[model samples]
Target: MTPASLVRRSETWNFDIDAYTNPYTPPSPLHRFPPWLSRFLGYRKEQKEDVGNVLGAVWSCVGTVLGLAVIAAVFNNTASIRAHNPPALIASFGASAVLEYNAIRSPLGQPRNALLGHTISAIVGVAITKLFQLSPHFESVKWVAGAVSCGTASALMLLTGTVHPPGGASAVLAATSPEIMAMGWYFVGLVVWGTTLMLGVGLGVNNVQRRFPLYWWTPVDLRELQRRRRRDGRADVENDVQPEKIVDVVREGEEKVSLGGIRIEAWGVEVPEDLVLSKEEAMLLEVLRERLRKRGDDGVLERVPSSRPSTDCTMVLSRSGRSGSDTEVLYSVT
Candidate 1:
């Protein structure tokens, strides 16, 4: 059976196959070799680090290297690469690189985020570093200043909902070099050419490997997500809710207090023990319930089927109960 299938099928039973049949231990930090033992009898042992199936890890690492290496080699000594270039041009290639790598390994790193995120951050990092270079105060401490600049860039990336780790490295590399730093506002091109080349390398190497998944993804939309939100309908599918909406809700101060640590208040209702809705879902449902829960609201305790339930037959109180309002409310599935 395939690794994924093996995991899925194994879940139906509870024998702890990982421990009995194929136990794995991560590499230890200590490599012991006593003075007497080191004289002639040296024992070498290999530890397992990549735990989510061996084949997958190797293929992923190989792809990652190819992706990073290609850009590094090309952009490191090129005049065409620089900062402050057009975003669309940068994204066109950068996004492709990331998407191609993810296509061979994971499917989530799509063209949109991958393109905009990496290029932008890399450029921003280079910009921040360049800003510090313009001042005579930071000239003597360029390395430290550049590192700090990258940190700030990383923070900006987090705030912007785009955190690409390699982008930081790319930025620091360009900013510290006198040649790249001199490129001034035009340094964005370096990131584009470098990142795109790396992704190209990853695509070429990964396509030849079998341990990785084929460059095939079952593209999913919101309707598909809603359909799969049921147990029987999407038993094998995994779901990931976008976290940006949650951040927006928090920024807007929607959930005032933690009702049983829920950070939202309501009446005539007990919060589920483990209501793990995404930030967007929580904020939306909270708002919807409050607006519908006016004092004269009827059927305050009505059963409404979930518009987006999980792949299980359990009911989620998608909307909260209001006090004495007039309204009829809305599940298990096959």
Candidate 2:
């Protein structure tokens, strides 16, 4: 059977309302660093492409050295911080430098994860260690305290959507290391300070050739999503149409297809049946589709004369709520 014949809309498929809603929209003043420093920051939309792996590796090393050095210099030189018996530089930050510099693209390396993950883990670790210290044999069961703190921090990080791997080490260090435990709640402040310094260095180093963060708060444009929802809601009210009824209509119009056992929906992506994609690949396609949709909504994609032959299968995209006369050819399949 032909590919078209294999395609059908799945009525049972449900829309993810949460995907379009972002709690971080109009993010707090603390999270407004990117916009405030827009000139210095680099986002995915601003970059045409990434650097080569060799260049990327070089920058990674530079970032790691600079980030760690800055933190160490500040910690070691400061009279108050240096007074601590074992020094103030947390060991876990070494792991964090790898993520922040080498694996800059990872979600764990993002500002939210880097800041909140380490902070939250530090808090949990300190609290748990204090409780264990109340026991007379606290020294004997210190390893147990370390294990418990790490596991608890991991769970809390996952729940809060801030899963930084180094955070686990921070928690363990707080519970097991005598020096870190002596720092008490002060350990939390050091974690935050070190993370902040590393991120600052990353911003400068990574943006020299590549984007440091794909996004500040989230990958989705929360503000745009909110505007779309409001516009849709107003239209529904004027038409006296229930939201459920509108969803039903949309579902009826959507097409679903399966290619080599992989399900595809009306998200504007198409793949050959023989082709297979990893989860990351599929997510990347979806992000690109979202960007295109946003650009289309802004009426930035207008029709232009095509130099290619007419035999090409061209896909046209028009501004939302506009007619075919305003459509523009987005891509052509040869």
Tens digit per residue, CA lDDT, model 2, 1-334: 6665556444455554335437436632334466536534654334476788999999999999999999999998887777765454678999999998888888989998899999999999999999999999999998999999999999888877788999999999999888889989988988898899999999999988787776676767666777887888865644452212111111222233434533233434444334444433444444444454466566665433323233322223223334656553222122
Per-residue error for 195 in candidate 2, Å, reads 0.5
For model 2, the stretches where C-alpha displacement exceeds 4 angstroms are 1-21, 27-39, 86-88, 235-334
lDDT values for all models: 0.45, 0.71
**Model 1 regions more than 4 Å off:** 1-114, 208-220, 223-334
**Candidate 2, pairs of clashing residues:** none
* Model 1 lDDT tens row, 1-334: 7999999988886433223312232222223666333221211243223224466556666666566555555554444442323222332344444445544334424332344456776677676776776778766877875687678767766555445555565567555766556665556655555555554555455444331222111223323444444553432322232222222212221212334533332221123445545444444544533544452255444333332222222323333346577433320011
By TM-score, the best candidate is 2
- Worst 10 contiguous positions by lDDT, candidate 2: 242-251
- Poorest 10 consecutive residues of model 1 by lDDT? 246-255
Residue-level lDDT for 240 in candidate 1: 38
Task: Report lDDT (Cα) of residue 305, candidate 1.
Answer: 32
TM for every model, in the order presented, reads 0.38, 0.62
Q: Which model scores highest in lDDT?
A: 2
